[model samples]
Target: MNRREVLAGAGTAAITSLAGCGGVSGLFARPTPEGVYVPDHVEGMEMVGTATLGDVRVGLTYSYPHRFWTVERDGDGYGTSRVDIADDDTVHLMAVPWDPETELVLPNTGLSVAIRTQGELVSQEVIYPMLSQRMGFHYGANFPLDGDGTYEVTVSVGGLSIPRYGGYEGRFDGAAEATIPFEFSADALSAIPYRQLDERRFQPGAVDPMSMDAVPTGVAPDPLPGSQLGRGTSGDAVFLGSVVTADRFGPDPYLAVSARTPYNGLVIPGAGLSASVEGSGPVRLDAAIDPELGFHYGRAVPGLTPASDVEVAVDVPPQVARHVGYETAFLEMPSFTLDAE
Candidate 1:
């Protein structure tokens, strides 16, 4: 219920604290403290929280384990062992088990640390086992799309594990995203770096296709990369005006605000504006509005109605003209610019 708590849980910045320090603050901070957490004190990295929405106070916890274990009956006696934690988005933890006598080198106690999600799991060869290397990292995907579902996030390191279910319990407009805290450390909440897993991250040391995989996909696109999206000014965009200029619009009349802008990409309403891509591509059309401003369709894509008073300024951009099928609507400007009120 506190503004500071809301800010901490919602921002993308990493929390600075030490994991396994055995407290609330350490469990939720960036740059976890040294010598705080050990192999014996992990419940598998869990995220726990309490909240009250209206009259309903949410008191719940979710848990996940890095690896599952099944007991095998050996002639009436049972033995417990490790099971696989697959799926790429598996959560990982940093457990530096130093020699009990000394407190620096690594230990080979048949235990390791890891994080897990619904997608995949990354293992030990990638996660060095030692106190000499003591920085933790997190990777996440399958981000919650709506505020009506639950997610299982688990962290396991040095035989101890913690699990917590992060949930969404409200409605939100605009582009949706939220920050989920980690059980081992708060940095886990915001340290999830989003990189295309299936595609190449970058070029390989100035090498060409021979040394690596750099061949272009076969089906050639019409226009090469870096081509101008369209002609004319971007402020002069057009769309089918949903509201009537005189409060009596009969048919869905289209309005072109920007004189010309046609590119193959996105047109986020609040993000300045995005023109068409390849003349025809996917666009995220929204209708959230601000009464004082133009009908806010989004950051880039905007406007609820056509400019009834603003006159046409210039010839339509060829790309815009062709894409909107507006060849006949091209009328030279009698008053090139809009008059200020």
Candidate 2:
């Protein structure tokens, strides 16, 4: 079987295990059921530190080098390939940035990292926004580090590229940087829990996302305000639609669709989406950030009634990169009609 098939199966099996149980809690809980299949449960990560850059608060952390995948546009959808751990790979570096005021994790922020020691550059690369069984949505990548010592890690965050709404206007529009010291050693890296699944390793289930005290997992707001259109699933990702009339969205009634992972509800950004009402033809939905809606795709529609037949299509899948559990999902998505119940 291909890698995606293997991971999907594994996730299914893991999630099924949580059927009757009260549901596991804690950061290191095993067999953590998720919406998608994930490989094994990785242990904790050592927080390198956190810094404030512009309107974003970035938290840096590290764990054992992990094998992940890189995403690329594949025809109308997307594709992914495994990126195995290199022989010299030292740690899987992660940068989690969020809006401090809103306390929401920021996606598509164009994040990059540069590691240095003794005034010399050690490693640098533009990290990918990833979803993991441990950390739901964050920017991360594996890096080869020099032998154990204190290193100055500088994280650079770029401006907001997507449309902003509500209180998010005119914010996160400037580039910012921050530096923090990280002490790395072989012993420290080895101490982080690393377990390989046996019978359930390749099963069709996913472990639950770990509880992180340092950084909040980027999740879409539940109970999205406005008249509820309905909920549906496409390509294992859940989509929820609602209609709201607001001055910010102009005179037309706005149709908002929140696309997220199934169980964890993490936001899926960088997607090309379109919607049609009562077979009124497709209308492009722009990626938007709002105070109440969080991250969603929406547009102002002239006539949207509660009984309107709405169909939302994933014209292009999410453009963000993926970790093990999410590599195969959010692609090959079919259109789903929104039930205005």
Candidate 3:
């Protein structure tokens, strides 16, 4: 896990649709179970602080591998107010509820949360990746990640008058820096076996080590469009489409990604696709990352605004420049949905 290589922000793919307006009441609404909401505290790990305001209860916990912390409402399903650590120095908040009253982030990340209240002083501190930028009552920023040091990251949700952090270390992968900020969750626990991505998700071959070009390596994609990446002979999981196998790391961390220009930015990110980690869990769609890009601005399309609609994911992990559009475009595959049995 290389944090600096892929610390990302929300993708602004759909900025134009919102006319560059995000965090508005209905600018980017999503579906959720309707009810009078009340926040809940999570149990386990190191409980930091808990506070309740305007019917909203918030708490913090210290997270490490093998520990669990969750957040829930009186009647809401359970999850956690979690900070997750990726392979590198990348850090993220998880299971944080998205309030309709809050504003939207368009398509900045694979997922986006809204702050619903402007003068509403809601604040949460995080681990790695400094956050320090705010747009109006909305907040967001990009922080860099390094696989080295330990650091502090704080995320405060107040008015957009306050700023969210941005680009921690200018987005570089495999950087040797100590960047321990945010918290940690399950995703930060381990390399989730492909099969366990979902329930009843079946797959063949090794986890994160599928075959491509009739060779063995990372989630290998088909060399030719019609080729096969894996054969699901072990269980039921299938390698939906081409996969990105092997990563050649480097100095010019972010360079260029192009499908037409082979080898330079070669990666197959099967979109809408799914793969199960054979023996353990459900099928989940994943794309191989470019260690160079390091999940920062490599995929940044100029002019992308705050309201662009993008996939529901953590900040885009960094990849060298070679990761730019190759996955999103070239390896266009169907998303893998959990076939719960």
Better of 1 and 3 by TM-score: 3
For model 2, the superposed segments whose C-alpha errors exceed 4 Å read 1-35, 75-77, 195-205
Task: Tell me, by lDDT, which candidate is best.
Answer: 2
- lDDT for model 1 comes to 0.24
Cα lDDT, all candidates: 0.24, 0.78, 0.22
Which stretches of model 3 miss by more than 4 angstroms? 1-56, 59-89, 95-143, 159-341
lDDT of 1 by residue, 1-341 (tens): 22134336644432233221211223333332221121211222222433222221221222221332222333543332333334332233332222122111111222322233344432222232211001110111111111222333332223211110111112111121112233432344334322111121121111111110111111112221111122232222322212222212123332222221122111212122222322333244232322111222222322323233322222221111010011112122122322222
Give the per-residue lDDT of model 2 (tens digit) for 174-293.
999999999988877766655555566435566777777767787787777888899888988888899989887889999999998886787888789999899988999998888889
Query: What lDDT does model 2 reach?
Result: 0.78
Which stretches in model 1 have alpha-carbon errors above 4 Å?
1-231, 235-249, 256-264, 271-341
What digit string (tens of lDDT, one per residue) describes model 3 on residues 1-341?
21111122223443233222211111234332222111111112232233322211222222222111222222332222322222232222222111122211111112122221223322233322111100001112212333333334332332121111132122212111121134334344232211112221121111121212211111222232211222211111122222222223222211112111122211222122222332323233233233222111122222222222222221122121111011111111232322212
Error of 1 at 33 (Å): 39
